[model samples]
Target: MPESFPAQTSAEAAAEPTVLARIEGVVGRLTLNRPRAINALDLQMTGLLDDALDAWEHDDAVQVVVLDGAGERGLCAGGDVRSLYDRIVAGHPDETAVFFRAEYALNARLAEYPKPIVALADGITMGGGIGLASHAAIRVVTERSKLAMPETRIGFTPDVGGTWLLAHAPGHLGEYLGVTGTTMDAADAVFCGFADHLVPSDRLDALRAALAAGGDPEATVRGFAQAPGASTVEAARAWVDETFSADTLAEVEERLRAHTDPAASRALQTMGQLAPTGMAVTFEAVRRARALPDLRAALAQEYGLVMWFGRTQPDLVEGIRAQLVDKDRDPHWSPASLDDVDPATITGAFSDEPAVPLWD
Candidate 1:
């Protein structure tokens, strides 16, 4: 077997670490080291990851890169939103903008990366985590993996190129998952096309060992998973497409509210519980993203909308407060109803204004 990634000489073990990196044979492994925060991707983590990926991309010896989280809680929860919330509380808008712009650029880079990338997502992947994993060439999920784009629940639309991924998810399942912040396990993720492979968590070590030994990374990963059955989400496709198939968010919600089907009823209840402005923005963003040429275009569009909504609107703060900050389960929404948002407001969110650049 070939030795650990020898492209970078600094693969030696370290005592104190921010993020972890090891070069084993042809694979460069990056582990998000902030286990205490469930491996949240702060600006520092994003920068480090981008830098490492850039290095690995050009280094011919590194044929692949592996991304995963540490300490077992999950892969990554996303940009440490609580920090962004604190910035908002401090009246610093540029802070959040800078963080997202850099992060989204990283996401776009990953999507367009030339080399093979594998993400072993084990648990609680959400928000920025979705950005990291969704763009990978190979995504592995385990029974412990719970994936979601839950920004709507936290008073933000799903950013980090979420609009792109959700727009492309099988059938209208993306629409349903995006709007509802629904959480799914490995099976559901594989069925919905979010995960490329589903392996038990216990098999990760062996799989990594094989990859480190210069095994065919792609086949090595596939070897761990059996062919999954048709997705449960796939079963709900007809109903999802019909109920969510509307030109506007208002009409979509109305259809959900009026429908008597059990699934529709449950959807309506979840919709009722979410922030009105967030729901409207999310639905609208996903719709607009579908027309974009590619993931980068979708991310750029989403980047513009989030800059406007995250800072100016009270929903982000209130949502974060209730969901993450205070954990009160009560968010006093500003408009209080989706109807309160006018057409101009939604249109303005999508305007191709002077958007913040992804890179300096």
Candidate 2:
């Protein structure tokens, strides 16, 4: 039997559900159905996922869970940043708090879920998408996967437990990816601990069938997942660890410019295009998260930083406008260069607690 809960908030009565949850054999399947937005997680979608998880957790009949996206482009593009930007520009920035709090809470729930959740980290999984997939018990990546925590590009630091994961990545890759917003391929994802297995995109259907047919999730995955080739991240580890380990962003640039590797050159150019405040804050956030006790602590710290960005920083709104809303590729970042960002702003964002609670 199949169960589908169509979203009721839609003006059209016949609109398809943005989230589809059903049972096949002993497996519970959840799909993010908003292909048009590349399955971006909105408030409604988050709530629906939470509800489905609540039901599945207690259902003895449902033994395994599979989460995938509806579209070919990816599992999820990330959170609905444009919607948040719209609310901010409307003079009601506080309204965005509900979405962030709910989303973060949902992420925590996923991290601790009782059942084995097989998350298909295929295609463009970034920002909020990584939160959903990477925390799962069984994370699968494919050759088509393009994974990143690309918040800095839009003048935002990573959230949704992003810092916690970034902090825990191998060597100095966390710091490298955190500031530059670099995308990782399957091998890189596996090497960096973002994914557990690499399964070819063509074999995904067989993989899903094996899961639904009710075998051990791990064993079934082992049968289908092939070993990925050498990670470029691994190849560049000497320069990555050495350059990014510098105490200051200035030194990071100095080291990067000195390296002859084309990877180093590309990274420097990408960093130049990012918002300075975002780079400064994200660099600190990744380092701070590494020192924190756990994911919950990192999430709390990230929540405070997000509130700071929403309420006080001009770069967040400006960056979103240029990148998402206006389609203009240029964002005149506040303090425009890494050298101009105030050190106090970075410290204060991590220190101050938000008025809204993530949990009651």
Best by TM-score: 2
**What lDDT does each candidate get?**
0.79, 0.87
lDDT for model 1: 0.79
Q: Candidate 1, residues 124-190: lDDT per residue as tens digits? A: 8888888998789999998788888888787778888888888888767777888888887777888
Q: Each prediction's TM-score against the native?
A: 0.92, 0.95
Stretches of candidate 1 above 4 Å error? 1-15, 352-355
Q: Kindly provide the TM-score of model 1 when superposed on the true structure, using C-alpha atoms.
A: 0.92
- lDDT by residue for model 2 (75-170), tens: 988888887788888887778889999989888888899999999988989889998999899999999998998888888899999999999998
How many clashing residue pairs are found in candidate 1? 5
